[model samples]
Structures are given as structure tokens and as C-alpha cells.
Target chain A: MLAKIHITLKKDVLDPQGKVIANSLSNLGFEGIQSVRQGKYIEIMLDGNDKNTATNKLNEMCEKLLANLVIEDYSVEID
Target chain B: MLAKIHITLKKDVLDPQGKVIANSLSNLGFEGIQSVRQGKYIEIMLDGNDKNTATNKLNEMCEKLLANLVIEDYSVEID
Candidate 1:
């Protein structure tokens, strides 16, 4: 099984990196860009075909290492 | 209006960052993790409801600054 994870900063968090990106975009002539928030996209290939197991394991990975739970949230897609 | 962009490495590219990340996952006891690839997810809020304009501008950003066209491909979603 393969899983894709999207991790984004919490709404309340101050995204300094995002702000920088937004400013850079504006300076680079992308004037239509109002705001920019950057995040992580991780693709993982797991061992077997058990959907439940893969989901649980990936969730564990997200919680343990892939994300900072206090400031970020992650969602998973499996195939 | 908002746009989401996903940037990923081309298959022929050597992903040393991904290799290191995969090894780190294994070392951290994520045994089921077979392969790990990392990418960027960018969320951009645009000025108006013109999806076509936003799409073109985002594509320009991707090609010019957000992604290395030599090794990365980017896709955009607008709303």
C-alpha cells in the first residue's frame, strides 16, 4: 500500500515562513498572490495490503515524527 | 480565492533527501515504511475569483521560482 500525507500549520500558528514566501512572491511580480502558506507532502510505501493496518501505522508515523502535533495537522490518503 | 500547488521530483531524479528521510524513519522504528518521498505543498490566496488568471500566474511562479523545472513538476488547484 501507498499513502500520501498532507501536513499544514494550525490556523492560529504564526507562519513566518509563509509570510516570507508571500512577500517574495509579491516582489517577484506575482502581484495576484495575496497570501502563501507552505506545508509538507509526504509519500510513503508500506509493506502490505491491509488498509486498516496501513492507516493506523501511517497515523502513528504522523504523530510520532512526521508532524508537530501542537502546531500542525495531517491528513492521509491511501492507495 | 485560493490555489494549492503540489511539487514533486521527477522519477529519474536522485532524491538524496528522500533517501535520508527513509533511513531516518527506519531508524526511528518505522519498520513498515518501504519508501519515503518528500515534497512541498503550497497554499496561495489570490486576489479575485478569476481561476484562469490565478492558474496562469501560479504556473509562472512555479516555473520561475517555486519549482525547478529540470527535476520537479508542479500541479495547481484553484478555488
Candidate 2:
């Protein structure tokens, strides 16, 4: 099984890296970009076959180490 | 319009960050028993209405700034 996780900053938290990217894009002549937010995409291969188990493990992983719960949110998908 | 992009290292490239995460997960008692790969997810809010134009601009942005073409691959989704 494979678990795909996406971790993104909470809406209230400021993202300086994303701001830099937006500014760089504008400098590169790309216009009309109102805002940019960056996050993490993680792919984990598990040696299990059950989707339920994978999902549980993925959520645990996010809570324990993958995401900074105070400042970020994470979503998991199992396949 | 909104553009969501996922940038990932090519399969052949080594990802030290991901390795560290995997090791940490293992040490934390999470048994993955496989591999983990990490990537970037970016969301861009555009002040335009046309999806076609947004897609084009997004591709250009990825090629020019968002991704390192030599070792990373990126996919863009316009919404």
C-alpha cells in the first residue's frame, strides 16, 4: 500500500517562503498571481495490504512526526 | 483561478530529507517497512478567470522557477 500525505500551514500562520516565491514569480514577469502557499507532499510505501490499516498508520504518522499540528494541517490518502 | 502544483524529485535522485524522516519515524516506533519520499505542494491564487491562461502561466512558472528541471519533475493543476 501507499500513503500520500499533504501538510500545509494553517491559514493564520504567515508563510515567508511562499511570499518569496510569489515575489520571484512577479519579477520573472508572471502577473496576476494574488498569493502563493507552499506545503509538503509525502509519499510513503507501506508493506501492508489493508487500506484501513494504512490510513490509520498514516494519520498516526502525521500526528507523531509528519506534521506540526500547532501550525500545520495534514491530509492522508491511502492506495 | 487557482493553480496547485506538486514538485517531486526524480526517481533516481536521492532524497536525504526523506531518509531522515523515515529514520525518525522508525525511531518513533512507526513501522513503515518501506520507503518514503517527500515533495513540494504549492497553491497559487491567480487573479484571472481563464483556466487555459492560468495553466500556461503555471507551466512557465514551473519551468522557470518552481522546479529544478535537472532533478525534479512538477505537475500543475488549474482550478
Candidate 3:
């Protein structure tokens, strides 16, 4: 099984890198781009016995090592 | 409408960042971790009249600005 996780800074947190990218976009005349938030896209392949087990283990992995829950938010898609 | 674009280095391209991440994962005891490839996830909010138009424009944006075709490959998800 493969799980894809996206981790991003919470909205209230400062994102200097995102700001820089947004500015660059505006300069390139991408007028409708109001904002940009950079994030991590991680794909993990698991050897779980089943989907249920894989989901549980991947969630645990996220909380333990993948995401900084205090200042970041994350969501996962399993495939 | 919002379109999410995922851009990643081509399989043949060298990814130092991904190598570093894979090494970190191994050190962290992620036993089955074979490799890691870092990528970009960009969400663009468009004001197009319809989905078809938005996709067309977004494709153009990817080719023109969002992706580096020489070393990167990209896919889009519309929502």
C-alpha cells in the first residue's frame, strides 16, 4: 500500500518561503494568485497486511515522526 | 475552482534533497523505506467560466511557468 501525506504550516503561522513565491508569481503577472502556502508531499509505501492496518499505522507514523502537529496540519490519502 | 498541481523531478534526474530525506527515514528506523523523492504541491484558485477552460489555462500555466519540463513532470487535480 502507498500513502500520500501533505503537511503544511497552520494558517496563523508565518510562511516566509510562501510569501516569496507568491511575490514572484505576482511579478510574473499571475494576477489571480492571491497567496501561496508551501507544503510537503510525502509518499510512503507500507507493508501492512490490510488497508485498515495500514491506515492505523500510517496515522501513527504521521503523529510520531511525519508531522509537527503543534504548528502544522496534515492530511493523508491512501492508495 | 481550485486546481492542485503536483510537480516532481523526473526519474532520471538527481534529487539530492530526496536522497537526504531517504537517509533520514532510514536512520529513523523506517525499515521498508527504499527511496524518497521530494515534490511541489501547488494549489491555484481560478476564476474560469468552466472546468474545461480552467484546465486548459492551467495546463498552459504549467507549461509556461509552473513546471520545468526538462527535469520535472507534473500532474493536475481539479476540485
Candidate 4:
């Protein structure tokens, strides 16, 4: 099985990295670009397991290590 | 318009970050997890534009700045 997780900062959180990228894009003449927010996409391949078990395990991993729950949100998909 | 991009490393490359992460997961008892790969998920919100224009701009951004094209592959979606 494989797990794909997406972690993104909360809407209210300030993203300096995104701001810098947006500014760079404008400077590079990529017109019309506005706001940019960056995040993580992680793919994990694992031993065989049922869907529910994989989901539960991956969620625990997210809460404990993958995501900073205070500022970021994470979603998991098992395949 | 908003653009969401997912950038990931090519298969033949070494992924030390992913390896470390997988080890950490095992150490933390997140059982069954085998291999891991890490990537970036970026979301950019921009001014209104036709789909073609948005796509062209975003693809340019990816090729030029958003991705290390020699080692990473990027996919973009406009919303």
C-alpha cells in the first residue's frame, strides 16, 4: 500500500515563502499572478494492509510527525 | 485564477529525506510503512485569465522557477 499526504498551512497563517515566490514571479514577468501558498506532498509506500488500518496508521503519523497541527492541516489517501 | 502544482523527484534519484522519514516512522512505530518520497505542493492564486493563458503562465513558472526540471516533474492545475 501507498499513502499520499498533503500538508498545507492554515489560511490565517502568514507564508513568507509564498510571498517571496509571488514577488519573484512578478519580477520575472509572469504577469497576473497574485497569492502563493506552499506546502508538502509526501508519498509513503508500505507493507500490505487493509484500507482502514492503513488510514489509521497514516493519520497517526501525520499528527505525530508529518504535520504541525497548530498551523498546518493534513489529509491522507491510501492506495 | 488559482494554480495548484505538485512537484516530485524523478525515480532514479536518491531521496535521503524520504529515507530518513521512513526510518523515523519505523522508529515511531508506524508499522507497515516501506518506502517514502517527499515533494512540494504549491498553491498560487492569481488574477483572472483564460485557461490557456493561465496554463501557459503556470507551466512557464514551473519550468523556470517552481521545479528543478533536471530532477523534478511538476503538474499544474488551474482553478
* Residue pairs with clashing backbones, model 4: none
> Candidate 2 - CAPRI tier?
high
lDDT of each: 0.88, 0.93, 0.75, 0.91
Alpha carbon deviation, residue B26, candidate 4 (Å): 0.3
Per-residue C-alpha lDDT of model 3 across residues A1-79, encoded as one tens digit per residue: 6778888788899888877766776777666665666777777766655777767766766787777999988887788
Instruction: Report the number of the highest-lDDT candidate.
Output: 2
Residue-by-residue lDDT tens digits, candidate 1, B1-79: 9899999998788878878878988888888777888899999888978778778888999998899999998999986
- lDDT (tens digit, per residue) of candidate 1 on A1-79: 7899999999889889989888888888778666789999988888889998889888888898889999999999997
Where model 4 places Cα greater than 4 Å from the true spot, the runs are: none
Candidate 4 lDDT over residue span B1-79, tens digit each: 8789999999888899999999999999777777999999999997886889888888999999999999999999987
Per-residue CA lDDT of model 3 for B1-79, tens digit only, reads: 7778888889899889877766776677666655667788877665655888767766776787778999999888788
Q: lDDT ranking from best to worst?
A: 2, 4, 1, 3
Off by over 4 Å in 3: none
Candidates 1 onward: DockQ, in order: 0.82, 0.88, 0.49, 0.88
- Give the fraction of true interface contacts kept by model 2: 0.94
- Fnat, model 4, is 0.96
Model with the higher TM-score, candidate 1 or 4:
4
